[model samples]
Target: MNTKVSRVYPRSLTFGDTTVELATMTAADAPALAEFVKTLPVHDRLFVRRDVSHPKVLDAWIGALAQGHVTSLVARDGATMVGCTAIVVDPLSWSSHVGELRVLVAPAWRGRGLGRALIQENFALALGLHLSKLTVQMTVDQRAAIAVFEELGFRAEAVLRDHVKDHDGQAHDLALLSHDVAEVQSRLRMFGVDDALQH
Candidate 1:
């Protein structure tokens, strides 16, 4: 579990006219990733558990990455970070097989296939770590996000009523979605990600 050992990724993907470099996040990336998160719209930031806009949280993620507790990937268009995805593995022994996925994409990059690419990269990482389950949580109103997950075969697993309260204390329902790692791998193979998954 040497955190410094880099994970190999597939070549960059081309979406429309842009080419996005896909790579894992390292401790050195904290500052840039933090700045990138801060540029996101408030609505996009609402679903994030870690306030990447805060230095402390970014430092925490750096530490986590160094300890191999989390694996994250970033999509960069040239030098600008456009999207990111992270999978956090459960530390408790009882739930160690489970991991949670967090994804964020710039508003301008939405609906152009970047999100799916990010999720696919996360799936490869989860499989590399031998995790059994992956889960994603989001407010129920994020229909587009939900659709993307569903398209990847993730099923709605649970609903926490009034799970999140906004800045004004208004509550929102949260949806929990999960994907079995084995099933996801099979799906990826069908989609021609077999070579990537083999890594």
Candidate 2:
């Protein structure tokens, strides 16, 4: 399939026993999203700053895309909610074609290639929207997340010390990684649409 058409069209994908489907969040998904976060471990929770006490957290995330500021993707396996990815695309005087990429995979689902699939799918979605760049945060503690981002062809752009808040409310540095959209798409095509966990 040609890159544009293949990626622009959304299709259901399967990986192992997991059937991954994509959808924009609605008010109805708020409950599932809340539930999804409640089940996450502390380490995983910090990535997205989970806080039900703050209703605005869900409000801004679920509505960011429709609000024309960001794109959010929810991944599901059967009826079980697995993970969510949020892509922030904001306009800037320097460059409006780039979209910021941020993602979090459920801790239990980590190591099963779910993160890669979610990222690639999200990347394609962002590209279909005409974005040409994607950026992600890389904290010193998140070695695994860093590896995944690097493997996906993201390059380290900068390191901002004390850039994020920890679970205990401590600040830490965040490594910024970026990838050219065209390069990421080409790499995923070479890597194929599915990984071994699927077979």
User: Over 4 Å off in model 2, which ranges?
Assistant: 1-10, 47-53, 92-94, 183-199
* The candidate that achieves the highest lDDT relative to the unseen native structure: 1
Which candidate comes out best when scored by TM-score? 1
Task: Tell me the tens digit of each residue's lDDT in model 1 across 16-47.
Answer: 78889988887767767877877787656556
Give lDDT tens digits, candidate 2, residues 1-199. Answer: 1112124223466788766776654566778777787776665445443443356887777776566666667777766668777777656446667777767666777788888988877766665666778888756688878889899788889988886786588887777888898665566568885232121
The TM-score values for the models, in the order shown, are 0.88, 0.79
Tell me how many clashing residue pairs each candidate has.
Answer: 0, 3
Model 2 weakest lDDT span, ten residues long: 1-10
lDDT of each: 0.80, 0.68
Error of 2 at 36 (Å): 0.9
After superposing candidate 1, which stretches have Cα over 4 Å from the reference?
A: 1-7, 186-196
